[model samples]
Target: MVVDLQARLRDALAGSDVDELVELGCDLADAGRQEQALACFQRAVDLGQDWIWFNVANTLRELDRPTEAVTAYQRAIAAGQSDAWLNLAHVLDSLGDLAGAMEAYRAAGQAGGQPEGHVQLAHLLHQQGEPQRAQAALAPALQRGYLPAVALAARWRWENTRESADPVLEQQLRAGAGVDGSARADLAELLIATGRREQAREQLQLGAKLGQRECWLPLGNLLAGDDLSAEPGQEQEVDGAEVDKAGAEEAYRAGIAAGDEWCHHNLALLLLQRGDVRAAEEHLLAGAAAGDELAQLAWQDLHQQD
Candidate 1:
C-alpha cells in the first residue's frame, strides 16, 4: 500500500511546482519514504523555493543526516521562517551542540513566546545549570496553564529549592488531572513524592487508560511489589504482598501495543522470571532497537551468558 502511494506521489511530483513538490514531499515523509521525501524537497529547494528549506531540513533530520539538516535549517531561517529556528534547536541538540541549541531555543522563545517554547527553553536552561533563569522562564508558561509546565515548575521547586510542592500547586494539579487525563501522570508523580502512593497509583491507572505512553513505566513499578507503606518517621516492616502477575502482564502488553519502548524492557523482565527466555529475548531486542539503554545491556548480558 505504501509503495503504491509513493509511486503515485512520484508521478505527481514529476509535473509539480515548488508548492506541489513540498506537498508531495510531506505525503512521502508521512508514508515513511524519508529519502524520497528528501529528494522531492531538494528539488523544490533547487527551484529557489527558500521556504522549502524547512521541509528539506526536516526530511534530512529524519534520515539521520543532521549536518545537512543544520545547513538546510539555517537556510530556512535566512529565508525569514523564524519558526524554523525552534526545530533547528532540536536538530542541533541531536547533534550534541547544546550551546547552539540553547541559542536557537532562546531565539524561538523571543519570537513566539508560547508556553510550550518557554517550557523547552526552561528545561535546557535547567540542564545547563541555570536554575534561576529556568525558573524565570517557566513562570509565564505556568501562568499560561500549560499542564506540563505546571508539573515542571513543581519538580523544580521540589528538586532545586528543597521545598515540597505548595498546597495550592498540588490542588491545582489535582483539579487539572481530574478533568484532563494528560495531566494525571504528572499529578501521580507529585502524589508519589508526597507519599500518597495509593492516590498516585489511581492516577497512573487513569493515565494509562487515557493512553499516556509514559504512565505505563511508573504504573508497572507500582505493581511490582513497591506498594508497601512505612509508618511515619520510622523504619518498620510493612508486609509486602505478591503482585498480580497476570494483571501486570496485561498492562505490559498494552503498553507494548502502544509502542512504548520501556514496556518492552519491563515485560522482558517478567518473561525472563517466568522462564520464557525466548520471548524475553524478543522483547529485549525490540526495546534495544527503540534506544532503551537498559534493554541493550540486558540483551548483551543474555548473549554473553550463552
Candidate 2:
C-alpha cells in the first residue's frame, strides 16, 4: 500500500479547517493510506479540534495501535462522541479486556449505537463462558431477524444439541459457504456428520480450489478415511478402503500454507502414527506456538512421555 499524496491534495490540506481535515483523513484511511490519515487527524486535533478525537481513535485502530486508540476513544467519549463508546468496546475486547468491553457495550446502548451492538455483545458473552447471558443479549437482534445474529444462534444451538438442521438455517449456511472459507469448512463438516462423506469431500475439494484454508482439514480427514486406524501394513484400510496418505499429507500442507494452524495437529497425528516422530514433533511444536489447543495437548503428551 504505497500511496503518494499528489501536490493538489497537499495544497488542499494546507488550507483546510478541522472538518475538512477530518474528511480528508477518512478518505485517506479508506484508500489504505492510514499513516497519512493519522497525520491529517493528528493535525486537526492539535488545532483545538477536541471533538475529532473519535476520528483520531479510528485512524489509530487502523494502524493496529489499539492501546493508543483506547485513549483517543475515551477522550472522544468525554467530548460527547457517543459512537466512540461502541468502538472503544471493540478495542477493549481485542485487548482481552472483556469485562471492560461488556461495560462499554452497555454504555454504547444507553448512549445510542446501532442495534447490531446487541449481536456483538452476545458473541462476546458466548466466548467468555456465559452462554445463557449471550442468548439473552441476542433477543433484540433476533426480534429484528438480523441474519448474523440468527446464524450465530443456530450455530451455537447446533453445537449443544446436534439436532436436525432447520431448513431455513441450512439455506443460510449454504449461502454463507459460497463466500467464506470457514463456512465452507463448516458446511462440509455438517455433510460428513450426516453420513454424506462423499459430498463433504467434493465440497471441500471445490472450496480448496477456491483458496479456502479451512476446507483443507476436512478434505485431508476424508482422504485419511476419517481417522480410521491403520492396519499393520496399511493406512486406514477397512472394508477395502484405501487411505490416500500422500493426498492427505498434501492437503494438510496446503492448509498450512494457506494459514490454517489447525492442520498441523492432524498432519502431526498422521506422521506420528507412521513412526515419523521427528517430523510430527516439529509440526506439533509449530501448532502449539500458533495457539492450537489440540496441538498443544499433543505436544504436552509428548513432553510428559519425556
For all predicted structures, in order, the TM-scores are 0.68, 0.78
Stretch of 10 with least lDDT, candidate 2: 1-10
Off by over 4 Å in 2: 1-14, 18-20, 26-35, 46-51, 75-83, 106-116, 165-172, 175-184, 205-212, 231-242, 273-275, 296-306
Candidate 2 lDDT over residue span 1-306, tens digit each: 233454424754686577777877787888888887888888887887877889999989988999999999999888889888889999999999988998888777557555567778887888889999999988776777666666667667556765535555556556656556666666676776776777778889999999877789889988988873464356355235677888999999999999999899999988987788899999999999999988999988977998
> For model 1, how does the per-residue alpha-carbon lDDT over 159-253 read when each residue is reduced to its tens digit?
54433356876665665564444456666767767777778778888888777766776677666544323222333221334465566677778
Model 1 CA deviation exceeding 4 Å by range: 1-16, 160-165, 175-186, 189-198, 224-306
> Against the correct fold, how does model 1 do in TM-score?
0.68
Instruction: Choose the strongest candidate by lDDT.
Output: 2
Model 2 CA RMSD to the hidden true structure, in angstroms? 3.9
